[model samples]
Target: MKLIIRWLLLACALVLLTQLDSGIQIRSFGSAMWAAFVIGLLNAFVRPLLILFTLPVTVLTMGLFLFVINALTFQMASHLLEGFQVQGFWHALLGSVLYSVCSLVIDVALERLLGPRFMPPPQ
Candidate 1:
């Protein structure tokens, strides 16, 4: 399924991220997979709540505060997982930004490869 493929690709991206950033350390491929899943779940369930609560600051900062929220979630993920470690606040912020970039690339690639079946028709 598309979901499974996307998860695997994201995990691979995590592995790649670790290679690209010294601050972000992933123990193994399996650990990367779990980290990816946890990150996805946090983004799905927790990120929106945090965004809503921080809306005033986020608006005041012209949406820049979302990066802080993302870093918090990234740090939370590191705390929750043994194999995935982000060194410090700065590392967390950088890692989160990198991970988000990787995720975006994966999503766009998937959408392109999967084509119209996974996309809704224009209104």
Candidate 2:
């Protein structure tokens, strides 16, 4: 239930991002949902690989390069979908930043609402 709620909220955030002229456009709620799901999958699967491959750069940049990895994941999602459009690399970079911020806010809100039971155990 919490997962579903988070997913829907993230989709809504994506829609709101399009309104901000973030250069990311979503054709419909369904598309936004798909985009959110794709992004999640990419983050779960691709992001780790990217981080590993760019470990040296990430270390050199003191983790700032993670933002570029996030942008690449965002752009990859846009390319895989028809209704989700990102203007270019820069647009993806901005969209990824916004999306990450929104997701963090949503997670915090959910944590407060649902309690720690739904959150992961501390590493």
Candidate 3:
């Protein structure tokens, strides 16, 4: 299912991030998967509300504030999950950016490889 693929991609992204940065640590594949699921849930539910409430600041910053919001979510995930760690605000920010980029790239590659049949239905 689409959700399973997303979780796997996120876990892969986390593993890649751990390899790239010493500040980000993931203890195991299972831990990474759990962290991915939690982060996905937070991003799905909390991030939108945060963005809506911070719309003025987000606009004032020309969307830059979203990165800060992402970092906060990343930090929150780190705190809520065991065996997954983001060292500091800077690390969280960088790790979040990296994770997003990696996820996007992987998604695109997978889509191209697997074709449209595997894509989730539009909302």
The lDDT for every candidate, in the order shown, is: 0.90, 0.95, 0.89
Q: Which candidate number would show the highest TM-score if scored against the true structure? A: 2
Question: Which ranking of candidates, highest TM-score first?
Answer: 2, 1, 3
Candidate 3 per-residue C-alpha lDDT over 27-52 given as tens digits, one digit per residue, 9 for 90 to 100: 99999998898888899999999999
Clashing pairs in 3: none
lDDT of 3: 0.89
Q: How high is each candidate's TM-score?
A: 0.92, 0.93, 0.89
Candidate 1 lDDT at 116 equals 49
Between 2 and 3, whose lDDT is larger? 2
RMSD of each: 2.7, 3.4, 3.3
Candidate structures ordered by lDDT, highest first: 2, 1, 3
Q: Across residues 4-119, which tens digit of lDDT does each residue of candidate 2 receive?
A: 99999999999999998658999999999999999999999999999999999999999999999999999999999999999999999999999999999999999898887545
Q: Residue 36 CA error for candidate 2 (Å)?
A: 0.3
Residue 21, candidate 2: Cα error in Å is 2.3
